[model samples]
Target: MALMITDDCINCDVCEPECPNEAISMGPEIYEIDPDKCTECVGHYEEPQCKQVCPVNCIPFNPAWRESKEQLMDKYLRLQADAK
Candidate 1:
């Protein structure tokens, strides 16, 4: 599952650098996570790094978007590839 930041986000940007997948980015009002890129930090970390660092606890599951484990891994791989 990809996580999303609600309007509760303070735009502190603490979450951005913590994401191992580079899934988090600054949004117009709050930070946004690309579902195509977000992996819940599954392949990268023990937990979602953004959620961990976000003090406001704005990050929550994006029910509007969903994917399987394989799909998440595929996106992680693709993001990794793009980084290279």
Candidate 2:
């Protein structure tokens, strides 16, 4: 599953730079995660970096964009290709 930044986010600006896929960004009121670009750091790290650095624990798995580990890996591969 992709991760989402909840309203509980303190906008501490810690999560944005931590995303390996560059999926986290500033929204109108807080940080937002792009489901299309989010692979939950499956291919890049053992865990989601944003969640790891989030001081408030506001990042959570997005149920609406649920995906399996294999699917996330596929997305990560696609993203890597696109970056080239």
Candidate 3:
């Protein structure tokens, strides 16, 4: 599943650099996550890096977007190997 930033987001910019997949970004004000680029850090880290650094705890799973572990891992690898 992809993660999203809620309105409660403080725009602290803490989560942006922490994302292994580079999914988070600065938007008009709050930070945003691209679902297509999000893999929940499935193959990159033990846990979601964005959620860990968010000061307001505004990052939450996007219920509308869901994918299996294998699919997420595939996405991770594709990004990982893109520079190869």
Candidate 4:
């Protein structure tokens, strides 16, 4: 599943660099996650790097973008291919 940053985000700028998928970015008022790019670290790390570094614990699963592990891995692979 893709994760989203809530209003509770402090904009401390800690989570962006931690994302292996490069899915986090600064939004109008806070950081945002690109669901199309998010893979929950499926093919990169064992856990979500953004969530691990977010101090306020504002990053949460995006229910609207619910995805299974296989789907996430497929996305990861596609991203990897695109990067090449």
**How high is each candidate's TM-score?**
0.86, 0.98, 0.93, 0.98
Model 2, runs deviating above 4 Å: none
lDDT of 1 by residue, 1-84 (tens): 789999898888799999887778877777899887889997788788898999999999999988877888888888888888
Tell me the TM-score of model 2.
0.98
List, residue by residue over 13-46, the lDDT tens digit for candidate 3: 7899998888988888778999989999998888
lDDT agreement with native, every candidate: 0.86, 0.95, 0.89, 0.94
Task: Look at candidate 4 and give me any clashing residue pairs.
Answer: none
Q: How many residue pairs clash in each candidate?
A: 0, 0, 0, 0
In model 1, the clashing pairs are none
Q: After superposing candidate 3 on the true structure, give the runs of residues whose Cα lies further than 4 Å from its correct spot.
A: none
Lowest summed lDDT across 10 adjacent residues in model 4 is found at 48-57
1 versus 2: better lDDT goes to: 2
Q: List the residue pairs that clash in candidate 3.
A: none
Residue 17 lDDT in candidate 3? 95
**Reference-based lDDT, residue 78, model 3:** 91
Tens-digit lDDT track of model 4 for 61-84: 999998999999999999999999
For candidate 2, the lDDT comes to 0.95
How far residue 80's Cα lies from its native spot in candidate 2, in Å, is 0.3
